[model samples]
Target: MLFGSDPGQAEFDEFVRSRAQALSRTAYLLTGDAHLAEDLLQQALLSAAKAWHRIEGHPEPYVRRILYTQNISWWRRRRFAETPLDAHEATTAAPETGDRDLRLSLEQALAQLTLKQRTILVLRYFEDLTEAQTADMLGLHVGTVKSTGRKALDRLRALAPHLEELIND
Candidate 1:
C-alpha cells in the first residue's frame, strides 16, 4: 500500500498539499531565493513528517516553527548574497504599473535585511500573526517581537522607500 493510504499519513499528505503554497511563499520571503525557499519548505515538511504521530490537531504551527528556526540556523552558517540589480531596475520610479515591479522591489529590499530581521517581518506581517504569537513561534520575548518588528520595518523603509509610500497610500 502507498504510504499516504494509512490514515495518519493521509492526513499529513492532505496538509502538505493544502498549505504548501503558503509555506513556499513564507519560505521565499525568508530566503529571497525560489530554489532555496523550495528546499527550505521541503526540509521543513520532512522534519514535520518525522513527528507527525506525536503532533495532534493542526501541524502548521509546528511546521512553521521548524521553517523559521531551520532558516535561522542555516543563515548562521552562510552569508547572504544579494542578487545584482540590473541597471534599468536600479531607478525606482513611481510604480505606474502592476504589482510585479513592487514585488520585485520588495523582494530586493527583503534580501538586504539580516535573516532574523526578515524572518520577524515575515512572521508578523506576512504570516498575519499577532506580536505575541510571533514571539511564541520564534521563542522570543513579546517585546523582542515588537522591537525587532519595528527595526525590521525601519530597515525596510531604508531599503525600499518606495514601499513606504505604498503603505501610506
Candidate 2:
C-alpha cells in the first residue's frame, strides 16, 4: 500500500524507532542539552508525522530536513536559555582517557558556537553529511555550507585550542 494508505501509522512508528537514536544525537549536538535534544526530536517527529504521506519513500532525507528546520526554528524563537555545561559536566563515557578529555573539550567548544555554526558542524561531522547534502538539508548553497563549516571549525579551534593537539594526536 502507498504511504497514505490506511496502514501508515505502523510504518511511521517503525521509522521513528529506527531513526530515534540518530535523531537524538543530532539534536543533542544542535542544542547542547539532553532535555532540549529530546524536545527538539519530539517536535521534529511530530512535524514528520504530519507529512508522512508525502515523505514515506525518502524518509531519511525528509526527516533530516525536518530536524534541521525545526532546530533552526527553535533557535530563531530565542528559547535557548540554558547555561553551557561546565568542564566537569562535559565529561563523556569513553574508556580512553584522551578521548574522554577531547570529547569534553569539543562539547564545551561546540556549546560556545552560534546555532548556525553548531548545526553546520553537527551536519558535517556528526551526521557525516557532505557539504552539498548539508546545504540541501539546510536550504543553503554549497558555498555557504563550506564557508560556514570553515567558520565553525575556526571558532571551535579558538574556543578549545587543545582540539588541535587532539586532532594531531
Candidate 3:
C-alpha cells in the first residue's frame, strides 16, 4: 500500500487540511515574519506526523505545544536584537481607515516586548488559553503566567497608548 493509504496518514492529512489556516495564523503570531511562520508550522506538523499514531483524539494541543516550545527554542538560539517601531512607522499609519493600521501598531507593540512576555501574551490572549493551560504548556507557574501577562499588557499600553481600547477588549 502507498504511504497515503495508511489510516494514520489519512487522519493526519485531514487534520492538516482542516486546521492549517488557523494553525498558520498562530504560527504567524508567534513569529513576526510570514516566511518564518510557514517554516515553524511545517516543522511542528512534521513532528506531529511522526507521532500521529500515538496521538489521542485531537492533535491541535500537541502540535501547538510543539509550536510554542519550538519558537522559544529558536528564539533562544537566534537571539535576534529587538528593534522598536520608529516614529515614522508608528505615526504615518492612518488608524481611522482600516484594521491594517491597528494590526501594524499591535505588531510593533508586540515586537517591543521580550520573547517571554510576547509568548505569554500570545498564548493568553491570542490563543485564548487559560492561565493554567498556558503555564502547563510553557512549564511555568500559573502565577508566573498571570504576572507576565499583566506586565506585558502594561508595557504594551505604554508602548502604544492608542491600542488601549483594543488591548482592554
Candidate 4:
C-alpha cells in the first residue's frame, strides 16, 4: 500500500515529523556536516521504513542502532576523507551567539578525534547513554566502551581545557 493511505505509514510519518530535528542533530554529530548528515539520515530512514512494520512504534532505538553502525561502516569504506576544521574557517562559520566560541572549540576538538572516538563521545556523553548501553549500541565490548570513553574525554580535555565542565561531566 502507498504511504498516507495506511495507518502504519501515517504513524511513521508523524514520528518523522516530530523527531526529524533531534535525529538530524544526532546525524550531524555522527557525520560532522549538515549535508552528509542529511544523507545519512535519509539512508537510515529508508532502512527504517523498510522494516517499519516490524519495528512499529519503537523505531527510535532501532533507527539509532542503524545510525551508529552505518557511520562506522561508512568510515571503514572511507567514502569521504575526514579533515580537521581550519581555525579561521571554524571561527568564520561559528554563529553569533553567547557560547559561539566555546561551541566552535568543541566542534573543532571533536573533529580532531578519530571517527570511533568521536562516535563514542557523542553516544556516551552527548546522547547520555551508559557505557554498557553504548557498547551494546555499537556492538563493542563494555571494556572497550569504558576505555574509549575515557580516552575520548582525555582528548577532549587536552584539546579544549576551557570546556572543563563538558569534558569532566
**Candidate 3 global CA lDDT score:** 0.83
Taking all chains together, each candidate's TM-score versus the true structure is: 0.80, 0.76, 0.84, 0.83
lDDT of each: 0.79, 0.77, 0.83, 0.80
Q: Tell me model 1's lDDT, rounded to 2 decimals.
A: 0.79
TM-score of 4: 0.83
lDDT per residue as tens, model 2, 1-169 = 2345568789888988898998888888998878988998888888888878777476877777777898888776774663334445543443335776678777777887778878988888878889998898888899998987898787666556657764321
Superposition-based RMSD of candidate 2 using all C-alpha atoms, in angstroms: 4.8
List where candidate 3 sits over 4 angstroms from the true fold.
1-5, 79-94
In angstroms, how far off is 44's CA in candidate 1? Answer: 0.7
For model 3, how does the per-residue alpha-carbon lDDT over 63-139 read when each residue is reduced to its tens digit? 99899999888877766665545444544343554688788888877877777788888898999889999998888
Q: Could you say which candidate leads in TM-score?
A: 3
Off by over 4 Å in 1: 1-5, 79-96, 165-169
Stretches of model 2 off by over 4 angstroms after superposition: 1-5, 79-96, 165-169
> Which residue window of length 10 is worst by lDDT in model 1?
79-88
